[model samples]
Target chain A: MRGYSGDKDAYLKRLRRIEGQIRGLQRMVDDDEYCIDILTQVSAATKALQSLSLGLLDEHLKHCVAEAVAEGGDAADEKVREASEAIARLVRS
Target chain B: MRGYSGDKDAYLKRLRRIEGQIRGLQRMVDDDEYCIDILTQVSAATKALQSLSLGLLDEHLKHCVAEAVAEGGDAADEKVREASEAIARLVRS
Candidate 1:
């Protein structure tokens, strides 16, 4: 509700579709789909996941992190830590 | 360089600080900061991290996902899977 605010439903719907895609990929692998084809599909899925992750990260910066920085309290420090962990995930992924 | 392509330096700087914040939190825990205070800090950090994650997710959706969906090829299906995994992470987090 915080950053997602008005876009929750849309975001969730998108996520559900992505999930289906993943399941499909699993099926493809199970069926012994061609290696290149499976990899192509995997690459596409990876890109999509990256897109979604980036979107959420942007919202967080614009709203929560920005606000905390402006407010300058314990909250700000905490936000910094939170943001760091998120970035770590992004980097690893 | 996909989504963060334009903002790479800025993003990296922000992430570095977040890492510091996390380290600070670890120190706080080690020093036995008040339970409430530690939790408060943890909460703040958690929120900040969520913000960052959401931001990245947003960008991915707007750029990569949108493009793939438009193209409607193997790419689109892969994107769908990728997006789904990202969402799953968000939800679990």
Candidate 2:
């Protein structure tokens, strides 16, 4: 079981919503919508993805990392390191 | 005709690819993939959206905003202001 397994339904819903947003962007382009308007939608989609990332990260830290820390071994250290790297990627993205 | 009209097909292709990425993310979640792995894919999708925004913004500045500025009127100022606001939103997102 993964850290996000419990929230799987919620995460899938968010991803599907974001998928709809991406489709909306394609439609806007097909109709020759104004560039700024398209960019605005792009920003909205990006923000949604970012929010999802943050939520997943929170759950990973709270569950995965916490469980590893409770075990107190090299696996715990590796999990923490992996989570940190994921956080960095999320921030930079 | 919009600034991106010339690149419409290319833009559509990119958006479609991002849509695919979003769907792939949904699959990852449904399969109970590791949290960090899911986060990685989320970052990839977010980065793709950002790159698409930058491409569209560049074209907008070169065409829409440029044409308005060349006309030299209140509309030009408004276009520039709108572009700036869009840039701000992109950065904040």
Each model's lDDT comes to 0.69, 0.95
Off by over 4 Å in 1: B1-93
User: What is the per-residue lDDT of model 1 for residues B1-93, given as tens digits with 9 covering 90 to 100?
Assistant: 475567678668778877888898899999988899888877777767776777676566545655565555677557646765665577555
Task: Give DockQ per model, in order.
Answer: 0.03, 0.95
How would you encode candidate 2's per-residue C-alpha lDDT over A1-93 as one tens digit per residue? 988888889989999999999999999999999899999999999999999999999999999999999999999999999998998998898
Docking class of 1: incorrect
Give iRMSD, candidate 1: 12.3
lDDT of 1 at B57: 64
True contacts kept of each: 0.00, 1.00
Residue B18, candidate 1: alpha-carbon lDDT: 79
lDDT for each residue of candidate 2 in B1-93, tens digit (9 for 90 to 100): 999899999999999999999999999999898999999999999999999999999999999999999999999999999999999999999
